[model samples]
Every structure is written in structure tokens, then in C-alpha cells.
Target chain A: MAKTVHPDQRYLLALLNNDAQLINEIYKKCAGKVKSFVCFNNGDANDAEDIFQEALVDVYNQAKYKGLELTCPFEPFLLLVCKRKWLNELKKRAVLPVTKEEDSLLHIGEDTFEQAEQLEKQQEQSKLFLKAFEKLGERCQEIIRWSLKGEAQEKVAEALGVTYGYLRKKKSECMASLMKLVQLNK
Target chain B: MAEDKITWTARFVEGDLSEAEMAEFEAQLQTDAELQQHLENYRQLQQNLRQQLAPDAVREALQQTLGKLNSQYFGHETQVLSLKPIIKWASGIAAVLAIGLFIWAPWRGNLYQQYHVPGQMLVAERGAASETELDKAASFYNDGKYAEAKSILEKLYSKDSQNAQLSYYYAQTLLATGRVEQGRELLTTVYNGESAFKYDAAYAIAMSYLKTGQKTECKSWLQKIAKGTTHYQKATDLIQKL
Candidate 1:
């Protein structure tokens, strides 16, 4: 069954549209809780701010790419995402013992957790892909970046000063190299 | 042959193949698991690349907007004022005026005494039964009988520890009675809660540190009170004296 999109998905659209007012509303309603939660969890305001910002960026990427639809309210969902990100950071830092947060018991539904986890996984893949892209030769990077820019292959080829047939062949080769690098990185 | 297969998979994923070639590729893909995996990886790569590399003015704009909002929302907690230049300038002027005027104009008395101005507890509108007891606690707090105030507030806090206002005043009473660690713990909890008492708790924590003559820690906490908060000016004033 298709889940009904929650009304709060407007926040995601706001991110896509750069709607400053709605984004401000998001900060006003949600940032405090995230800051509070991070501060309570052996993190400070700076850590909370970084985690919150990164979570918003991840959500933007997910909505931009995967056409993410919210099946849950945005606030709790955003909080859960930020909370998980901070916990991951805490684990990485290893400066403090990661205690089981009381709010981890918050019942936001399994779908929300699934959504947050999916975004995290996609973000991890993006990181891997980006690192691999960086390791590719400059020509390959240029071809791949241009070809993926939603332009016609012919126009991309023209922009890159290459023939259409060459652009297609070389883009595939570059992508294949990229895929191999990503596999190696993983 | 291997490179040809990879190229065909990418072309199939990107819709670059003609109908006849696509048909042939799909037919081969059904039986060839390696080709199927190659197709899947290319498809995933295409999606990821489009998402990652596509020119997104909105994404840039959103990032800029989020940077502004992050400052507005979480900026105050770590925004320490750079006092070195100002202090250097002040000392320069003090040397030029060298006629018995001190740079520390605000250092008239004990730093804690000058800055530890706790707000009155006025949580009476919560309920009738609690109102009388809270008002009594408020009276004791106002009269400087923090022990009496703590006795009542402690009892109330035990029932509703999540209440920011209660935790704040209880923390104040604990600080007043010299239970600095216990008081700071409560204040930290209040500071960590999403209540209006957050900066107030920070100010109280600063005052607690100041009372114990911990100037560095006090100034550190004081600097956490960003501009525009009720305690910002007072915290800065004390920071200057310190």
C-alpha cells in the first residue's frame, strides 16, 4: 500500500525550493530540541549545530535524488536523524561512553527509522562515490560530471569538445572506472 | 569483450542505446547475472551522480540559508567575544591617562555579588495547590533563605524533574546554599532542555563558577551567553571585569 505523504513533507519541498521562511520555521520549531538533545548527550552546542546542519543537507540530498516522501512528521523524523548522526559522531570520537539515550525510546514508528537509515546509507554511498570520483583521471571526472548534468549527451559532448560517440563511450568507461574505484574503497 | 559489456550496460542504464540494442541487451541481461550486476551498478551510479553532480542552485541556496539559521539557532552557545584586542586598547588608553584611573571600572566589589542576580521564581500560575507552595518557596528565595526554598522546590522537583522552570530555581537554591556541583548539574540539565531558561541557566552556571573564584571557567561560561539574550550584557559586563 502506498503510504500517505505527511503534510510536514513541505519542509522537504522547502529545502528543494530554498524557501527561507519555512526553513526558518524548521529551525525555530526543531533546532532547540536538537541542541538540547545533543548537549545532554555529552555533546555541546557546536556538535549539535554541525549534526543538525549535516542532517538537513542529507535530507535535501535524499529528497533531491530519491524523491523522498515523508510518511511521518518532519520534526520527530528530523530529530531522530540528527540524534542518530550525533550518536554516530560520538561513537567515532570515543571521548565519552555512549549511554542509551532515554529519548531513543521515543516511538516515532519503524518507518521513520527506516527512512533515516536509508538516507544515511545513500549518503555513505555518495561519500564513497565522491571519493572514487576524486581518484579518477581529470578527463574521466570531467566527462562523468558533464554527462550527469541532465543535458543532452550531444550537448555535453559539444561542451566537452568531444564527439557524441566518443562522449558516450568514454563516459561509460569513466563510470566503469568510478564503479571499480568505489568497490575498492568499500 | 569485457569493456564492451560494461559500455553496453552503461548505455542501457543511461538510455543511450537504440531500441534494437536495448532489446538485445535486456535479453542477454536476463541470463547473464554479471551483466545484470553491471547494469544495476551503473543505474545506481547514474542516480548518485545526478544527485551529487547536478547543478543545484536551490541546494546552494538552501545550504546558505541553513548556515544562517544554524548561527541564529545555535550560535550563542559557543560564541566567545575576542577580548584581547579590546583589552589591549583599554590598557593603551589607561597608560596614556595614567592618573589613578583603573581599566577595570566595574571591579567595585566581589564579582559574584555584583553578578549573581537571580530572577524571582513566579511559577504560581501552574496550579492552585502548587501555587501556594511555590509562592512560599519564592518568598523564601527572595528572603535569601535558600535552604527553606530548596526544601520546598526539592520536593516539587522530585515530582516533575523535567520542568525547566522548577529545575532552574532549584538549581539556583542549590547554588545559593553552596551545593555547587549539584546545582550546576541541574543547571546543565536546564541548559540542555529546550526551554526559555536555557541562557538563564548558562548565566547561573557562570555565576556559580565566579563564586568559587574560577575566573577562567566563569568567563568561558559567560561567553556562551550570546548577544540578544537577557543575560548577555550582564555576562559581558562581568566578563570585562574578570
Candidate 2:
């Protein structure tokens, strides 16, 4: 016999399947809980959204690859996920000496220490990459930033009001310039 | 590797080469030490550029925008409603109008004359239906069906000429579909208008311009949006990214 999928799983699947209204409704229902969790972790509303987004992405990845099986109510499960994400973020920020107030508020999951360490390392690498990115020319900086946002060459060309061929050449030149700058700084 | 190959290496790291060119470039990277170092340096520089350009103010502004969205859609308990009520009310009104037109001719005539007959009614119905269509388009967009959403939004825009919301969303759909010029033109109208979506339109137009690589135009439009109330946060964020 096939295993039965839980309501939370069904709801999440529907959300991941592009039911925006339903997803919006779910957000409405649990946003407060997520916000509270973030606040407890010394994160503001922006941090709350970041945590929510990250949790959603995590859930999406799980649904896509692992076929996640939700064994609890969606509200609690979502809150838990968001809580975990926010706590990890806090740990990375080195908000240090995790206060008893935060500890009391959190669910105190098993993966906390491991995830905290991982997040700290990732944050460190990101900081280094960002430091390296700062040495490029203004134009090169803009091109690379837009490219990272996944803008296409043709679109970038049109935005600059240049020919597609020219834009491609410029992008390469900008990258080369950036490489030179980084090498000089190093 | 030769110095000429080293220069092309920059294009390869930036993903600016065509597929065939990329294949050739990758083949070159396999054996070239100087080219590899150049590529690594380029990657590091790009990362640094992002760090330098990402303003703290932009992040704060995004947080504020998220706060507003939360307040509007999530924080306010009274506003947190199921779609059923709005759907019920719209359908109810539509049904009443339909019934009145068929059965109560005198009442219908009075309303028709007051509202300019079937023309106005048609417009109203079209407006409501267009909103529904736009909602569908948004769903399609979130689902990554940019072409389908663009087609629907375009059809809706054609039906309703003065819908700033539709125009704004249509422009977004166009941008997503890689029709940058058309998207910019459509969004420009909304951005120039004094309508409710003006700020959002301005911000989106700026983003579209940035996507197309018009840094100067994008900055100008972003400035306009940043000065506006409704889209200040988003505009600020885009400005920083640019």
C-alpha cells in the first residue's frame, strides 16, 4: 500500500505548484509566528522575511528532490523551519553569548550547533568574496551585479541601448578589467 | 596560454560567450594556467564589487518594504481574509446586474442610462475580468510560465486601455519574456502617469532599463521612483544593486 501524504505536505505541494493565492494565505496565517521567532532571535522584520524566504526555499528544495513528508501541522512546521533558519543566521552574525531569553524562546533543535558552525563559515567566505568584489571599476561592478541577478546579455545590451555584439565585448572587457583590479589589490 | 587567450578568458568567466564559443573556451581552460588565474581573479573581483555596491541603506529599505507588505497582508488581522468573500461579492453583483438587465427592463434602463448603457457595463465587466486575468498571469509568472503570462496580460491590456495596474504588470511580463523595448514603453506610460501604480511602474521601468544595460537611464528612473512614496524601498534597493 502507498503511504498517505499529510495535509501539510499537500498544502506545501499546492504552494510549490504555483498557487499564489493559497501561498499568500499560508503566509498570512503563519507570518506572525515567523516574525515572533525572528524577533526572539534579535532579528527584525527584514530578517523575518529573509528567514521565511530561506525556509520556503529549503522546503521547496526538499519537495523537489527529497519529496518531503510533513508529519505536523503546516503552521508549526513552517515556524520551526523559519526558527531554525533565523537562529542559524543569528549564530553567523556572532550575536554571541546566546542569551537565555533566546534559548527559552526557541524550540532548541538537535542540529543547532552544526548548522551554526556551517553558517559561520559560509558567512566568512561571503565576506571575503564581497571584499574582493569591491576593487573593480564602476561599470564592471554594475555589469557583474546585473549578471548575478541573471540578466541576459541581450537584455543588458538593450538596457545600455547598445548592440548585442558590443554588450558581449563590453562584458568580457569589464571582467578582464575586474580581474586586473583584483590581481593588483592582491 | 597566449595573452589573447587570456583576454578571452574574462568573457568566459562572465558567461558572455555563445555556447560554441563557450565550449571552445572551456577546452582552452583545461590546459591554460595564466587563463585560469585570470578567471579566478575575475571571479574574486566580481564578488568584491557586489560587496562594495550593496548599500546598507538598501537592505534597510528592503526590510521596510517587507515590513509594509507584512503589515498590509500579514500583520493586520482584519485584512487577513480568504478570497471567498471577495469572490462571492463580485459574483453576486455580476449576477444581480445580469438578472436586472433581463427581467427588470425599466430598472435596467435607468441604471444603463445613468452608467452610459452596455458600454460602461462592458467596461466594468472587462475591468473585473482583467483583474482576474492579471491574477492568473501573476500565478503563471510565479510558475515560470513567462510567455503564457505575457500573452494573457497583453490580451487584457488590449481590452482595457486605462488600467495602470494591468499596464504595470504587463510591462513586467514583457520584461520577463525578454521583450525589453515593449516592456519599457508600456511601463514608461504608467511611470509617467499619476495613477496608483505610478511608483511601482517607475521602479519596474528602472529595473527593466538596468536589465537591458542602460545604466544611465536606469539610474535616472530609479531616482524618480526612490523619490516617490510607494516604491521608495524597492527603488532604493535597485539603485544600490545597479
Worst 10 residues of 2 chain B by lDDT: B115-124
Best by TM-score: 1
How much TM-score does chain B earn in each model? Answer: 0.54, 0.44
Supply DockQ values for each candidate. 0.28, 0.14
Name the weakest run of 10 consecutive residues (lDDT summed) in model 1 chain A. Answer: A97-106
Clashes of each: 0, 13
**TM-score of model 2, chain A?**
0.51
Return the TM-score for each candidate structure. 0.57, 0.38
Model 1 score (lDDT): 0.79
Question: What tens digits encode model 2's per-residue C-alpha lDDT throughout A121-156?
Answer: 443454455554555554655566555554677787
Given the true complex, what DockQ would model 1 score?
A: 0.28
Cα lDDT of model 2 by residue, B1-242, tens digit = 23475568876765667799889878877898876876775564554444333233433333333344555543333333556656755775577466534643444433212221110011122223235555677667656677897788777665444568777777777777766665776777787678977876776676665655687787788788646474575456546655
Model 1 Cα lDDT, one tens digit per residue, B1-242? 33467767766775667788889888898899988888778778777887767767677677778878888999654434466546654764455344222332355566666667665555433323334577788789867799999999987775446568889999999888876766886797788768988999999999888888898989998998879987887788778878
Local error of candidate 2 at residue A45 (angstroms): 7.9
Task: Provide the overall lDDT of each model, using Cα atoms, as 2-decimal numbers.
Answer: 0.79, 0.59
